[model samples]
Target: MAPISIRNNPDRLRYEVLDGDLAIGQAAYVDDGEGRRIFYHTVIDEDYGGQGLAGRLAAQALDETVAAGLMIVPVCPYIKNYLGKHTQYADNIQKPTPALLTVLNNALARRTRR
Candidate 1:
């Protein structure tokens, strides 16, 4: 089995899951500059989808968010759902503002249409 490693790539607004030298998944986010991060997308390569990469990605990302003393605005459904199951990360979650909610909804809709 290939070993997977997780790393934050803030320059690209995402946390990546690396399988050796290959990137197999990512969870994308935007820093709101108000000490909060809005997670917007979580994706795994189709070939890598069933291997629990998304869970690993979510865990690392949320754990780092807490470590950074930042709150989470889970704009992405995958993240919202992940947090639901985990709950341990609940203390860091923040409700999004109306404007931010609109933006996130639009993003999700756009992806669904694609």
Candidate 2:
């Protein structure tokens, strides 16, 4: 098995989990550039599933976002469900507002077009 690690890839606007040099999972987000990062998607490769990589990814991503003084806006079902059980980040979580939803939708649309 390869060693696993996670890191923020700002250029791609996501937190990626790598097994050695191969990326196996990602928690994608969009920084609204106004104090919040909207996590819109998360996925772990099927081959890498059942290993808790998603939980680890979400934990580190949320940790870094809080450390950076940004609000957490979990729009992805996995992330949203994770947040419901993990209260450590409750203080940093911001309920999704209408405007924030729009921001996320627009960003996702651009990604689809590209």
In candidate 2, what are the lDDT values of residues 1-114, reduced to their tens digit?
A: 789999999989989999988888999999999999999899999999999999999999999999999999988999999999999888999999999999998988998999
| Clash pairs for candidate 2 | none
Candidate 1 regions exceeding 4 Å error are: 102-114
Candidate 2 yields a Cα-based lDDT of 0.94
- For each candidate, the alpha-carbon lDDT, in order, equals 0.86, 0.94
State the local distance difference test value for candidate 1: 0.86
CA RMSD of all predictions: 4.0, 1.1
Q: What's the distance in Å from true for residue 19, model 2?
A: 1.0
TM-score of each: 0.84, 0.94
What tens digits encode model 1's per-residue C-alpha lDDT throughout 40-98?
Answer: 88999998878788988999999999999999998789999998998888889997789
TM-score of 2: 0.94
Cα misplacement distance, residue 46 of candidate 1 (Å): 0.9
